[model samples]
Target: MYWHIEDSRYRIANPIQYLISKLGLSMDSLSQFVLGAAVSTAFLGRKIGPRKAALVGGVLGTLPDLDVLIPFADPIDSFVYHRGWTHSVFVHALAAPILGEGLVRLFRGLRDHRWLTWMTVFLCLSTHAVIDAMTIYGTRIFWPFYPDPVGAGSVFIIDPLYTLPLLGVVIWALFRRNWTSRLQTSVVAVLLGSSAYLGASLAVQRHVEQMALEIFSDNGGKPERVLAIAAPFNILVWKVIGLDRDSYRNLYLSLAGGNEPLEVYTHPRNPELIACLEDTPAYQKLDWFSRGFNRAELVDGRVVVSDLRMGLTPGYAFRFVVAEADGQDIRSVTPKRDLSLRRADAEDFAWLGDRLLGIPAARAAEAGFQSTTRDRAAFDCSTD
Candidate 1:
C-alpha cells in the first residue's frame, strides 16, 4: 500500500501531496477500495439491482481502510499504524452485521435478503485485506490474534495493469440497465484475466529471485534474503536486492538485459550510525518492520535512517532523523518525520525508462548519485 501514496494519503503536509491532489491521480487506501468496490458491485449487482449493489459495495469496500484517517505523531508512526489492526479479518466479522443491518434499514429493498447484504459487506472488508496482503508492504490481516504482518510481495500497490481491467468492467456494468447473459460473460472474462495476470506476475518474481541469488553468489557472497520488486509501472524490469550478513546488494534486471553483467550496487547498513541508539524501542520497531533492509546516514549533523524497500537507493521515501549526533555520540534519538524524498520529476522518470531499456545513459545515472549515500564506491562518511 506504500505506492498507494500516488496522490497517496500519507502526504505529511508536503507540496507533492497537494500537487497529486490537483492531478486527480490517487493510489491511496481509499482509492484502492473504490476500485475494488466498483468491480465487486458490478459482479454482485447482477442478481440484485445495480444501484443498490453499488451503494453496498462502494460504501462497504472502503470501511476497512478507515485506518488512514487516524493521524500519528510522525510519518513513521503513521506508516506503522496503517494496514495494521483495521485491515484485520476480525474487523470484517465484527463489522459486517452492523454495516449490513444498517444498509438493510436504509434501503428497505434489502430487508428480504439480509443474509445476501451481510455477505456482500463481508466480501468488501475481507477483499481489502487480501489485496493488501498481495503487496510487498506489510498488512496485519490476522491482527489481535497474531501481531505480525503478512506480505506476499507479489505486486506493487497500484499496478494499472491490475486495476484498469476491473475499472473497464465497472464502467461497462454501470451503463447496463440489467445484467444480461452477455454482461455476465464480460464480467467473468475480466475477473479471470485479472487473476491470471496476478499469477503471471508472481511467477516472474520467482524467476527474478532465482537469478538474483545466483548473481549474489557469483559476486563472492551468499544471499540471506532476496527481494525482486517490479519497477514503477511495468513488470518487464525489476530492482533486485539481496541481503547478506554484511550488507544489502542491489541490481537492476530487465528481460532485455539477459546474460550480461548486472552492475550490482552495495549498500552497507552503517550500523555505526545507530550504535548508540540500537537498543531504543523506536529503533527496534523500525528494524523489525523494515526486515533489516534499512540504512543509516549522517546528513546535516543528524543521523537519519530510511527503509530501503519503499524506494530506490540514495533517496528513499521514508526517512527519519532518528537522532541528534555530535561526532558519533548521540545526544538524543527520537522518531521525527523527514520528508527528504522529492517527487520523481520528468528527467528522473526518463532515467528510469532508459534503465529499463538497458541504455548507456542509465549507467551514468548513479555515477555521482551515491555521493550522498552509503554506496561502497562513494567516499567514506564521517559523522563529524
Candidate 2:
C-alpha cells in the first residue's frame, strides 16, 4: 500500500537515528539552541562587553533547553516534550523580558543598561526556535495556540557543512575585537553561505523526490506520496520512501547518481495489526507523528510497530510490541519500547558510507538482478 504525493505531507524526521544509536552519543535540543546562541551572540553580544559575550550567549542561548529538566518517562517522552511549548515563540518572547530584566537587576553594572541587554537576550533566545524549525527535528514555534511542531526539513540537526563555517567565524570573533568590520563581514558571509546551503539541500531534496516519483511509477508502483530525507552528516545521498496504504517502498538515491535507476524495497504495513490494538494511545500517536510512514509487521504472530521515519526497516529507532493476533482479535497487547534491536551495526554503517560516496550497495531493492554482483566497496569500520 502506498500514499499519494498530493495527499501526503512529507516531513523530514531525524533521519540519522541508526548512526547516532551506534555512536552512543545524542545531542539534544538544549545543545542545539546553545550552538545557535553562540553565533547570534557573536553579532548581538557587542551590545554588552566583548568579554561577557560568551556568558550572555551561552546562558541566554541555552535557557530554552532548560525544558529538558521538566522530566519525562524515557527518551521518548523527552523527545515529545523537550521542544514543545518551551521552544515556542510565546515562551521565548515571554521569557526574554523576565530573564533579561532579572539578569540586569542582579548585575549592578547592567541595571542602567536594560534596553541593550533586553535586545541581546531577545535575539539570542528568539533565534533558538527559528533555527530549530530549519532542522526536521520538530520545534513547536507556535506552541499552545498551535501545538503542531513546525519542521522545514531543510538541514540536519548537526551538519558539519553548516556548523563549520559558523563555528570558525564565532571562534575568530571571540578572539578579535567586538564588532569589527572584518568580524562582521565574516559573520555575514557565514550566515549567507549557510542559508544558501540549506536552500541547496531543499533543492536537492526536490530533485530526489521527483526522481523517486518517476522511478516508482515506471516500475508499476503508483505511490501516493514520498518523503525524501538525507543521510546523516551529508546531503549528497538520501533515503527516499514511497508510501501507500498496504505497503511502502524504500530505497537509496544518491545525488551523485542523479536520474539513475534505483532498486525499491517493499514492506507491508499490516494495518490490521495496528488497528486491532484497543487502548493503544502510543500506537495512534506514533502513527500520526510518523505521518503513516510506519510499518506494522507480525513477528511470530505478534505485532511489532516501528517508526519508519528514523531507521531502516526491521530495525527502526522506535519499535514496540503493540499487539498479538488470535484469528480475528488482538490480545495481550502491550506497547513497550524495544531498544534491544540492532538498528545500526558495522555492516550497515559501512554500507551507508559506501552509498554516501557514490558507491551504491550491491543488493538492489526490488529485483536483485540489476545491482547484484557489483563490487562491495569496503569502508573503514574500525572506529565504529
Candidate 3:
C-alpha cells in the first residue's frame, strides 16, 4: 500500500491499496476534520453533547473535499478542478443556512440556538477553504466571480505543529462522555493556538520573501516573481523560488541560518518549448494553474512542462508530456503524466534535517538537483 500510494505511476492492485491511496491523499481532509470537530465541540458541544457535535463537524469538514470524486476528462482536469466549486466560499455561504436548518430540524436540542448552529456550520465549512488557501496548492474560494486560484504558500499542506494540538484536545473531549467547561476551554485554546501557528507561518513567509529579494538583488538579478513555501512538515526551513525570464532560481533558507550566503541553483525555463504548445489546452491550464511558475523542457523528443512550486528541482510533482517532437515540428499530444523522474529518498530528509538546524551540508545536488539542459541542445529553436 505504501509503495503504490507513494508513486502515481503504479496502479492499485487491490482494494486495500486503493483505500490506502485515498487515505494518503486525504491529509488535508483530515486536518479539516480536526478543525471542524474541534470548533464545533468548542461551541455546540455543551448544547448537543461533545460526541454528536464532533460527528457533525467531522462530516462537514470533509464535505468540501468531495469534489475529488467528481470525474474529469483527464488528469489535467482533475488537477485543476479538485478544489473548484465545492470549496467555494460562495457555495459554503449558500449551503450553510440550509444545512444548519436541517441540523436544527433533525436534532430538537438545537431548536433555540438556530443562529449559533448556522454560524458553526458556516465556520466548519469556510475554515476548511481558508486553511487550504494557506498552502502552496491553489484553492478557488470565490468561484464564479474569480477565475484564478488563491494559494498563499505560507504553510505546507500538512503541518503537525498546526494540527496535532487541536486533534489531541478533540480526542480528549470525545472520550469524556460529557461536555464540561474545562473541555470547552481546552478546545478553544488549541484552536487559538492553531490559528496563531497559521499567522506565524504567514509572517515567516514574508520574512523569507524579503530575504530572497535581497539575495537576488545583491546578485544583480531581478526576478519577475518570488515565491516562498514552507518545507514538507515544518516552517522552520523554507523553499524559495525566483522566476526570471529564461531561468528560475531555487534556494533553501533556514530561520536559524541568518545572514549566511546561501547557494542558489539556476535552471532553464525553456520557454521556446512551451511556446510551441501555447495554443494547447493542457499548456494553458498548467500555465494559469501554476501562475507562470512553470518550466518546460524537451525530454526524449517529448515536450514536458512542470509546476516548480510543488516538488524539488528536476522532479516536480506535476509534470506532463504535452507534446511530441517529430524532427523540428512540435505536435501536441494528449497531456499524460510523466512519472519517470525520481522521488525523494532518505538522503533528502537527512539533508532537510541538517538544513533546518542551519547546519551546512553538501548541496541540493545529492537531493534532486540534476542538469536539465541535456536535451536542450538537440532541439535548437533559435531559427524557429
Candidate 4:
C-alpha cells in the first residue's frame, strides 16, 4: 500500500536519454555515458578532476539505497521496510567526514584539491536527500534534530511521461561534452518542470477527494476520513470510512472510472458483530506473519475467522476461511450456508480465538475430517 514516490527525483533511470533528448549523445550506450558524465560534472574542478569525480558521483549516487539488503527479509517485507535511515541526514553527516578523511589520505599528494574531495562527499550525499524530498515517501532530512517525514507529494512512482525527455537530454549531453553548460541547465529546468507537474497532480488528487466526499453527502451519508488511491496512472479510487449518524452504517465509496459521478458501495465497518481474535498460542504464532489481518467471529452454528488483509480485493466472501468445533478442539468445517450472517456483538465472535489459528483443525487430523493417514492406510490395503 506504500510507494516510495520520492526516490525518482535524483535517481534517474536513464540519465543518458535525459542528456541526449536535451543536449546530443544519441547512441545505444547513452545511459552508461550520461551516468558517467553526471558524476564527472559533479566532481569537476577538484582534486579528483573529471574522471574521478564521475566515479565518485556514480558510486555515491547509487549508494543511498544499499541498506535494503537486510538479512532474513522476505520478498514482500522488503517493500514495506523503510530504506530511510541510511539515506537520512544522520548517515550523510557521519559518512561524509569518514569518506572525506579517507579520500584525503588516499589522494594526499594533491593537497591543493583536498577541499574538492570533501565537497564531493557532501554534494553526493546531499543529492539523496534532495531527490527523496521530491516524492510521496517523505525523507527525514533533519534527522536526530527532527524525525517528521517531509513529503513533497510530487510525481507518481512510475511516470514515463516525465522521464523520457530528461533521459534524452542526459544522453545528448554525454555525446556532445562541449555543451555541458546547456545540458546541465536543461537538467535543472527538467527538474523544476517535473516538480511543477507533481504539484499539479497533488491538486488533482485533492479535487478527487472533494468530489468523493460530495458524492457521499448527496447520498445522505457523511464520511470521516477518505483515502484516495491512484489506480494504474490517473484513475482515482476512493475508500471512505464513516459511521452513519442514525442507522450507523459503515460506508465505502469508489470513483474509479472517471469524473462523471462516483460509484458508491456501503459496508458495515463498525458492525455490531465485530470479531476479535483473542490471545491464544496458535493465534500468537500466526501473528508474526498475519500483520494485523486476522480476526475471529462466530456466525450461525459455527465459528468463522478470517485474514482480512490477505483477500482484500475479493471482499469478505473471500476473506474468511470457515471452521467449526468438532468437540474440545475446533475443527475445519466448510461454510454450509450463506456467508452474510452477522454476529450480535463483538463478544459473539470472541469464542473463536482458537479456531482462527487453525490449531483445532490441525489437531483434527486423526478425527473424521480429511486426514493424510486415512488416505495412506487405504492405499496400502487396497488391491484394486
Top TM-score prediction, candidate number: 3
Q: What residue pairs clash in candidate 1, if any at all?
A: 4-27, 5-8
Q: Rank order by TM-score, top first?
A: 3, 1, 2, 4
Distance from true location, Cα of 296 in model 3, Å: 0.7
Candidates' C-alpha lDDT: 0.68, 0.62, 0.80, 0.41
Backbone clashes, each candidate: 2, 15, 0, 25
Off by over 4 Å in 3: 1-9, 12-24, 258-261, 366-384
| lDDT tens digits, residue span 54-161, model 4 | 455556655655554554232223333344566576778678778877767766534566666666676666655654554444456676576554544333333444
lDDT score of residue 336 within candidate 4: 27
Model 2 lDDT, full chain set: 0.62
- Give lDDT tens digits, candidate 2, residues 1-384: 000011011122333544454232234343344455465555555555433564567667666666766766543354445567877888777777888798687756567778766776777776677767765556788989988767655555657787677666656656654556666676677767876887898898888888878888977567987888777667887778888876787767877663244567776775555555423665666666566678766666566778776666556656766566565445644455655455666677776677777776743223442211211121111100
Name the runs in model 4 displaced over 4 angstroms: 1-58, 72-79, 100-154, 176-179, 234-258, 266-384
Decide which is better by TM-score, 1 or 2: 1
CA deviation > 4 Å runs, candidate 1:
3-25, 29-31, 256-259, 355-365, 368-384
| Every model: Cα RMSD to truth | 4.6, 10.2, 3.8, 16.6
Per-residue lDDT of model 3, residues 237-317, tens digit only: 888898886788887888867435567777889867866767778889999999989998878988899989987877677
Give model 3's TM-score versus the native structure: 0.90
Model with the higher lDDT, candidate 2 or 4: 2
**Highest lDDT model number:** 3
